[model samples]
Target chain A: MRRVVITGQGTINALGRNVAETLQAMRDGRCGIGDLEFQDVERLSIRIGAQIKGYEPEDSFNRQQIALYDRFTQFTLLAAREAIGQSGLSFSGELATRSGVILGTSGGGMNTLDENYRSVYADGKNRVHPFVVPKLMNNAAASHVSMEWNLKGPSFTVASACASSNHAMGQAMQMIRTGMADVMITGGSEAMLCFGGIKAWEGLRVMSKDACRPFSANRNGMVQGEGAAVFVFEDYERARTRGADILAEVVGFSMTSDAADIVMPSKQGASRAIAGAMQDARLNPEDVAYVNAHGTGTTANDKTECAAVADAFGHHADDLMISSTKSMHGHLIGGTGAVELLACIMALREGVIAPTIGYEEPDPECALDVVPNVARDVKVNAVLSNAFAFGGLNAVLALRAA
Target chain B: MSDSIKDRVIAILAEQAMLEPGDVSMDQSLEDLGIDSLGLVESIFAIEEAFDVSVPFNANDPTEGDFDISSVKAIIEAVTGLVATQAA
Candidate 1:
């Protein structure tokens, strides 16, 4: 079995445009959630989100490419470019045949769907653009990455709602570890900040009208966000032999389903996944330092996740630092875990723990140190990133310092 | 109190609570009717549609919202007020 390591990483989110900028913002505890700007936003009761403002498609892609690529695909490509460039491994010959790509996305081309729906239904147009199907498909981002990088091996997209990225990355790690592939270009992307996207989510009544204040007693609900984060996962020996900069080690991943309610989370299910990930990594609870929580700021999620963490770590839960970066970047849905994974890597490499910002009133249920409202400087050996999505799907990933 | 509004509210609550309209009483609270958070939200939406008046509600803190769900009568009063205001 081959050991997997993350050789390169890239991201573009509400907080920043690239890895450096994003990490710096995390260190600064900056909040990217604010007033959402999109069509029919004024009509929505919840009119705020962590949208990537001032982004122009024309600047990154030609007219034809823009027409063919959806916003989510574009974001994935941009992050993939940075990640693959950082890895410095060209895809050709045997390497290309042995490498692959897998990306995660919930609303694959929501913007494209929203536009075409409007064209046919609202605007009374008879036909939509010819590329609409290809642009809006769920596998578009993964397919584009495979084509762009010439990854001739396995390629697909995973969609498990919010846990899509973690599942996708976990699959990539398994592929490399089992000698299924030499390298896997993997991560997640989401651009669902469009009118139809927000409007659909608004019906759920789980969105905050203002900020995402995870773990705060005053927290109302989750704020939506949009972005992408991509990474290169290669065999550890291969990366070391090539002198590639290893970001973090792909250690362990565990996924669980509650088999309970669809929208509600189960503490037992989450705790199982948390404990299972640690068991898989052969890491004791004390060995872990920080946990990037799936704190969605919702009345149910924040408390439920806190309870799960406490149950999994037992007494050590009191000593460990757990923070939700979603408080800063907002919940990116399927793309969230990948962006949140950046915080885990930062804790391992930079010794900086991202804070759970917007903390005000203390939540007795979430009594653990949330590292509230201010970044902390701490060297950590192992960290866990948790992603629990709707439908009771839970995926927990463990990483060690490289 | 408008009789039609009361009847319509009771019908909506009954539908959501999965009970007979006759079983719902003005003294009964949403909890008494077995209306959970999701059911309460759906009831609110139904009430707003029935009267064609927007109900200012945020499920984050149901108590903080202007709409009152303390009891059936309280909800009727809030809806009546909203309906009158919209008519004005």
Candidate 2:
């Protein structure tokens, strides 16, 4: 089996548009949650969201392409551009055939759906937009990315809710390890801050009215966020021969499902997923230093996740430096895992753990360090990124410093 | 207009599209704002619940239900028309 490593990474979120800016924002302990103002959410009691500001679709695609794609696809393309550019590899000839794209998204083309719905129903118009199907499908982002980048091998989208991206990455690593593909572009994107989307979340009643405060005693609930994160994964020897800048090694990945509940999370499922990843990497729990928690800031998720960590690592749970980058970026739903993975790679490379901001009071149920409010500089060797989604989907990835 | 009728229209818009009072106007077109076709159908259900009246639908063309449903005025017109015919 061949080993896989992340040669390049790119991200766009409430914090920044690229890896450098995003990492800097995380280090500076910035919170991206703010009042939601998308021209239609004036009545909803919950208004705050981590929206990506100043992004234009025209900047990433041509006029014809823009008409075919939605905001979520635009985000995927922009993040893919950054990842491929950073990787310094071109898909010119056979490379294009061998390379593939895998992306995850939950709110695929919701914004487009919102627009077309208004045109047909509210306006009493019979004519629908031309790109409605292409825009609204959940796989549209992956399809757009593959077509834009000319990736022909095994391109598809994964939708495991919040765990979608991590599951996509895990599948990409397996494909390479099993000699299925030579190279893969994997990540996730979301653009669900539209008025209709926000209203849908309001019914769930898990949104934080003030701000997202994960692992804090005063935690309310998660603040919705939007953006994309992508990574270039190549075989280790292939990357080394090309003199590519290796960011981190994809040592192991694991996924598990808790057949327990629809919305409620389970510690057993989360713990098993983490342990399974560690076993896959052939590393003990002690080898893992930093943990990027799911940490959705909800009353149940935070406490349940903390218990899972403690159950997985035993005594090391108290000492392990865990933090939820979601506290900074808010929950990106499907894109959350991919962005959190970028934070893991950064933590492993820079030897600094990003803090879980908005952690005011410590929840007695969540007793982990959580790297609370301030970034910590430490010599980290390996990191774990955890993503647990609704309906009991759980995925975990283990990365080591290259 | 009866207070119940006005309240029913407002309530339908608020519940179906998650709109607030300031964001919605009786004369405003729903298309100009953001409520889509799915939103319109959902709003119809909300209207039924609010006014204890079931708006008639054209079973032949399901798509017709979504067209021209922009403002509360348009919705009221559609619903009142249906109610009058049903009474007759």
User: Which 10 residues in a row give candidate 1 chain B its minimum summed lDDT?
Assistant: B56-65
Off by over 4 Å in 1: none
The sequence of per-residue lDDT tens digits that candidate 2 reaches over residues A1-402 is 899999888888999989899999899999988877676688666789999877777776799888888888888888898999999987858888888988889888888998888778888999987778987898888887788788888889999999999999999999888888889999899888987888887655567778888899888778899999999999998999989999999999999999988788999999999999999998788999999999998888889999999999999887899999998898999999999987898788998899999989967899989999999999888899999999999999999999
TM-score of each model, paired residue for residue: 0.98, 0.82
- Residue pairs in steric clash, candidate 1? none
DockQ of candidate 1, scored on C-alphas against the true complex (2 decimals): 0.63
Cα lDDT tens digits, model 1, A1-402, are 788999999999999999999999999999998888988778878888899999999999999989989999999999999999999989999999999998889999999999899989999999888999999999999999888889999999999999999999999999999999999999999999989999888777778887889999999889999999999999999999999999999899999999998888999999999999999899999999999999999889889999999999999999999999998888999999999999999999999999999999999999998999999999999999999989999999999999
Candidate of highest lDDT: 1
lDDT of 2 by residue, B1-87 (tens): 455666667667766667776677788776655665446556766766655665543212233344345467777676666555555
Measured against the true two-chain complex, the DockQ scores of the candidates, in the order shown, are: 0.63, 0.02
Candidate 2 chain B, poorest ten consecutive residues by summed lDDT = B56-65
lDDT at residue A335 of model 1 (Cα atoms): 96
TM-score of candidate 1 on Cα atoms, chains taken together: 0.98
